[model samples]
Target: MRQEKLKYLAKLALLVLMGIFGSFLISEAGLRLMNISYPVFHGFDPVRGRILEPGMEGWFRYEGNAYVKINSAGFRDVEHPLQKPKGTYRILLLGDSYTEARQVSLENTFGRKVEQQLQSCERLLPHLVEVINFGVPGYGNAEELITLRSRGWAYDPDLVLTMFFSGNDLIDNFPRAELREPAYIPRPYFHLDQGELKLAYNFQEWSPPILKYRLLLWGVHNFRTLELLNQANRVLAARHIGDSQENLSSRAGLADFVYAPPQTPIHREAWDITEGILKLMHQEVLKHGANFFLVTATSPDQIDQEERILLKERLATKKLDYPEQRLRALGEIEGFPVLNLLYDFQQYAEQHPAHLHGFSNTKLGAGHWNEQGHELAAQLISKRICQDPSIL
Candidate 1:
């Protein structure tokens, strides 16, 4: 009996060791096959498969296309190690994912389109015009302000154009502990004091190099694992509101799943926070001797107001509120030039129905610009820039 027990114990120990070795081998093989490398936070390294520089420092791998840090501010493709040329007019473009050209290629981005147009012009003011794309995904006025203050001045921009999206930018600016780090990572902070909003640095804490490396390794080798973790996070986020019904809808046409937060009042304290961030951003732009222009984008709700209202009513029936009016009102405030593209895009879409072909038809999903959309944005923006004698 004793000899039989010993044999069983040895067999169990061998199985455990084999399992451990198997896991390690699988992880190592996965990393090797994927060619993954550790990405530096806030630094752009192209060799390691990192696209986009000087921001959150994560590998932006989507649809097999990669973007490394192009030296131009925002999303502009220009000569690296940017040197302000004697006769070049520098323009800095700032915004969120839409401005980052997430759904489109680098050359197809609006900033690149504008640059191409400017270069094509052989008329009098043809010395040289440089438009840099400083837009980062998930950034709001706070991050935009910080980026402008920190990096915009270096390029000596003659004009700074900031794009605002209604859906996420406001949410991005709100003071939430969940947005601290490792997820929804941001570089700026807003403080609300007695109805007044203040801006401050929120990026003091740094991720350890080893942890960052591990995350990179995991991100590359275990994408499915990270995806599962993200899904788990969404489930937790939904549970935070204690609501039975959830909007577990993903972005339109794309399989990427997103957790939709419970509807909150449009005029809630969040707008106050957003307003404060914008105020600081405007002031910062002026401080650098650069003119600021506010360009707005369309959300799906804005595309069909009646449908949005109905959706809001449904949420309201459930004791939830959506901050639609507050956002529009905030945009109306006096300060910089505001280009509300919601109305214009809707009108254009109505006239030319063909433009909607490339976009997803789902009303709940976010809309991306096709070639027409990009052209329209470029034309309107460029026309506005030319109209402003100050920018010239």
Candidate 2:
């Protein structure tokens, strides 16, 4: 009777193992068949910081299950040829999330919209307006400059638009543990050493875990099921640590230290770093004979009357035109035309307040440029470029 029971148990165990294997095969196949690759990865660069894992195509479910296919070149946009075609007017756009524009469809992105608007121009129609988006999320001045240096210069653009998001860029320009730890992405930090830019936290390589946990990183990034589990684990960890949903996931913006003044020593330090980077960027653009334009992109809080009041109250300020003045000053100093969009956004918001409904956030009610907002920005940009006597 004992021998018979042992044989039966062995048979049951074998059946269970087979069932598990079969389920794994099915799940793996389903995910692949659906083009739902797991773990859309971000590669840590020693120089600029985290880059979109190149050549990865998958659905990033975070922003309304948004489908993102990171081009082989590692940009968020479609693949662009390196060689400039004759008569092609290329515009290299550099910025952060507002410029990366994951919040909307590619067609709805401001850069593409700018392209569409330029296409409508009779004079510009003879030339192709190819706006290369080098906008990476969580990027600040240093990273943008690095991106332009590494690859943007090769594009042979006629113009370079460095869109500045005043909200969080000040803080993003420098490294702070409070801002970066939660995000868990390695970033290259910079400082003006003897009035020259120097790398501080040079590469993610310094973080031993990035190498030690290499397999874990790959598995988490490449496997969708693992990524989902990782996301769930992160949420749980955030809850356990008593962190807010935004605190854990939010990129640096809004509650900005650089703009919120008592003008602490650190804040002032950030300003210097930012200015130095801009100077370098401008000089580089000039070297290539491309006109550089600085567009100060506004956050919703800066435009919405109600939101503006609340933000100022939090910052304990009356009104913050600090960013605009600073940007315009840099434009004067660096010799790049600064297109301050503060007035444009305000006037548009006042005229069509209903458009705020379109600026609705897909995740956590975090408002960004909706379709209408993109249209406004694009039209403004196109108009400005058209009016510029030299470039068009």
Please list the C-alpha lDDT of all candidates, in the order they appear.
0.57, 0.74
Q: Which pairs clash in the backbone of model 1?
A: 51-67, 51-68, 73-133, 74-133, 74-134, 75-133, 75-134, 76-133, 266-323
**Residue range with the least summed lDDT across 10 consecutive positions in model 2:** 356-365
* Cα lDDT over the full model 1: 0.57
Angstrom error of the Cα, residue 369, model 2: value is 1.8
Q: Can you give the lDDT of residue 238 in candidate 1?
A: 50
Candidate 2's TM-score: 0.83
lDDT of 2 by residue, 153-187 (tens): 88898999999987667767865635545435566
Estimate, for each residue in 63-106, the C-alpha lDDT of model 1 and write its tens digit: 21334444433343545345788888778888877787645556
Off by over 4 Å in 2: 1-41, 122-125, 177-179, 182-184, 202-207, 212-214, 234-254, 260-262, 355-365, 390-392
Q: How many clashes (backbone atoms < 3 Å, residues ≥3 apart in a chain or on different chains) does model 2 have?
A: 3
Q: Best-fitting candidate, measured by TM-score?
A: 2
> Which candidate number maximizes lDDT?
2
